[model samples]
Target: MKTVYFVVLLLVALTYFTTIEASAIPHCSPWRCQQECLFKNFMKGECIQLQCVCSQKIGGIRP
Candidate 1:
Protein backbone atom coordinates (compact mmCIF):
# COMPACT_ATOMS: atom_id res chain seq x y z
CA MET A 1 0.00 0.00 0.00
CA LYS A 2 2.29 2.76 1.19
CA THR A 3 5.26 1.21 -0.57
CA VAL A 4 3.36 1.06 -3.86
CA TYR A 5 2.49 4.74 -3.59
CA PHE A 6 6.09 5.64 -2.90
CA VAL A 7 7.25 3.69 -5.93
CA VAL A 8 4.70 5.45 -8.13
CA LEU A 9 5.88 8.81 -6.85
CA LEU A 10 9.47 7.99 -7.57
CA LEU A 11 8.60 6.85 -11.10
CA VAL A 12 6.70 10.06 -11.72
CA ALA A 13 9.69 12.11 -10.68
CA LEU A 14 11.97 10.13 -12.95
CA THR A 15 9.57 10.53 -15.86
CA TYR A 16 9.46 14.26 -15.31
CA PHE A 17 13.23 14.52 -15.41
CA THR A 18 13.71 12.24 -18.41
CA THR A 19 10.75 13.84 -20.20
CA ILE A 20 10.90 17.53 -19.28
CA GLU A 21 14.52 17.55 -20.49
CA ALA A 22 17.44 15.32 -21.48
CA SER A 23 20.32 14.03 -19.42
CA ALA A 24 23.98 13.29 -20.07
CA ILE A 25 25.60 9.86 -20.28
CA PRO A 26 27.55 8.54 -17.32
CA HIS A 27 31.27 7.79 -17.45
CA CYS A 28 32.91 4.28 -17.16
CA SER A 29 30.65 2.58 -19.73
CA PRO A 30 26.84 2.47 -19.71
CA TRP A 31 24.76 -0.53 -20.96
CA ARG A 32 24.56 -0.18 -24.76
CA CYS A 33 27.51 -0.17 -27.18
CA GLN A 34 31.10 0.55 -26.20
CA GLN A 35 32.93 3.89 -26.62
CA GLU A 36 30.43 6.79 -26.38
CA CYS A 37 26.94 6.48 -27.88
CA LEU A 38 23.45 7.89 -27.34
CA PHE A 39 20.50 5.47 -27.47
CA LYS A 40 16.94 6.65 -27.94
CA ASN A 41 14.01 4.32 -27.17
CA PHE A 42 10.65 5.27 -28.77
CA MET A 43 9.03 8.65 -27.98
CA LYS A 44 9.58 7.89 -24.29
CA GLY A 45 13.00 9.42 -25.01
CA GLU A 46 16.46 8.20 -24.13
CA CYS A 47 15.65 6.66 -20.79
CA ILE A 48 18.23 3.97 -20.21
CA GLN A 49 21.84 4.41 -21.36
CA LEU A 50 24.03 1.41 -22.16
CA GLN A 51 27.74 0.76 -22.92
CA CYS A 52 28.18 -2.93 -23.76
CA VAL A 53 30.53 -3.89 -26.62
CA CYS A 54 32.01 -6.98 -28.26
CA SER A 55 35.50 -7.05 -29.87
CA GLN A 56 36.03 -9.07 -33.05
CA LYS A 57 38.99 -9.23 -35.47
CA ILE A 58 38.69 -9.86 -39.19
CA GLY A 59 41.12 -11.99 -41.19
CA GLY A 60 43.50 -9.88 -43.24
CA ILE A 61 44.60 -12.77 -45.41
CA ARG A 62 41.67 -13.27 -47.77
CA PRO A 63 42.35 -14.76 -51.20
Candidate 2:
Protein backbone atom coordinates (compact mmCIF):
# COMPACT_ATOMS: atom_id res chain seq x y z
CA MET A 1 0.00 0.00 0.00
CA LYS A 2 2.82 2.42 0.79
CA THR A 3 4.50 1.67 -2.54
CA VAL A 4 1.26 2.29 -4.39
CA TYR A 5 0.84 5.64 -2.70
CA PHE A 6 4.40 6.62 -3.52
CA VAL A 7 3.89 5.68 -7.16
CA VAL A 8 0.75 7.79 -7.36
CA LEU A 9 2.52 10.75 -5.83
CA LEU A 10 5.39 10.40 -8.24
CA LEU A 11 2.99 10.28 -11.16
CA VAL A 12 1.24 13.43 -9.99
CA ALA A 13 4.56 15.23 -9.60
CA LEU A 14 5.60 14.22 -13.11
CA THR A 15 2.32 15.42 -14.55
CA TYR A 16 2.57 18.79 -12.79
CA PHE A 17 6.14 19.29 -13.95
CA THR A 18 5.23 18.35 -17.51
CA THR A 19 2.40 20.89 -17.58
CA ILE A 20 4.68 23.61 -16.23
CA GLU A 21 7.31 22.93 -18.83
CA ALA A 22 4.75 22.89 -21.59
CA SER A 23 3.39 26.25 -20.51
CA ALA A 24 6.89 27.73 -20.29
CA ILE A 25 7.76 26.68 -23.82
CA PRO A 26 8.48 29.54 -26.18
CA HIS A 27 5.89 30.17 -28.88
CA CYS A 28 6.84 31.25 -32.40
CA SER A 29 4.96 33.84 -34.41
CA PRO A 30 3.37 32.61 -37.60
CA TRP A 31 4.34 35.88 -39.31
CA ARG A 32 8.04 35.20 -39.14
CA CYS A 33 8.26 35.79 -42.91
CA GLN A 34 7.09 39.41 -42.59
CA GLN A 35 10.05 40.51 -40.54
CA GLU A 36 12.49 43.22 -41.66
CA CYS A 37 14.52 42.49 -44.75
CA LEU A 38 18.21 43.08 -45.46
CA PHE A 39 17.96 45.57 -48.34
CA LYS A 40 15.74 48.58 -49.17
CA ASN A 41 15.24 49.82 -45.67
CA PHE A 42 12.74 52.36 -46.99
CA MET A 43 10.52 49.75 -48.59
CA LYS A 44 7.21 48.81 -47.02
CA GLY A 45 6.18 45.39 -45.83
CA GLU A 46 3.12 43.19 -46.39
CA CYS A 47 1.96 39.92 -44.91
CA ILE A 48 2.25 36.90 -47.19
CA GLN A 49 1.72 33.41 -45.94
CA LEU A 50 1.70 34.85 -42.42
CA GLN A 51 5.16 36.35 -43.03
CA CYS A 52 6.24 39.95 -43.47
CA VAL A 53 7.67 40.34 -46.94
CA CYS A 54 8.70 43.44 -48.82
CA SER A 55 5.85 44.98 -50.77
CA GLN A 56 8.23 45.69 -53.63
CA LYS A 57 11.07 43.48 -54.81
CA ILE A 58 14.48 45.16 -54.51
CA GLY A 59 17.03 44.74 -57.31
CA GLY A 60 14.86 42.13 -59.04
CA ILE A 61 15.03 40.02 -55.88
CA ARG A 62 12.56 39.58 -53.08
CA PRO A 63 13.80 41.25 -49.99
Which residue pairs show collisions in model 1?
30-51, 31-50, 31-51, 32-50, 32-51, 32-52
lDDT of each: 0.48, 0.63
Query: 50, model 1: CA deviation in Å?
Result: 20
> What would the per-residue lDDT of candidate 1 be over residues 1-57, giving only the tens digit for each residue?
999999999999999888665555343333334322333211121223443433332
Residue 60 of model 1 has an lDDT of 31
Candidate maximizing TM-score:
2
TM-scores, all models, native as reference: 0.34, 0.38
Lowest summed lDDT window (length 10), candidate 1:
38-47
**Candidate 2: clashing pairs of residues:** 33-52, 34-51, 34-52
Runs with alpha carbons beyond 4 Å of true place in candidate 1: 23-63
In candidate 2 the C-alpha lDDT for residue 62 amounts to 64
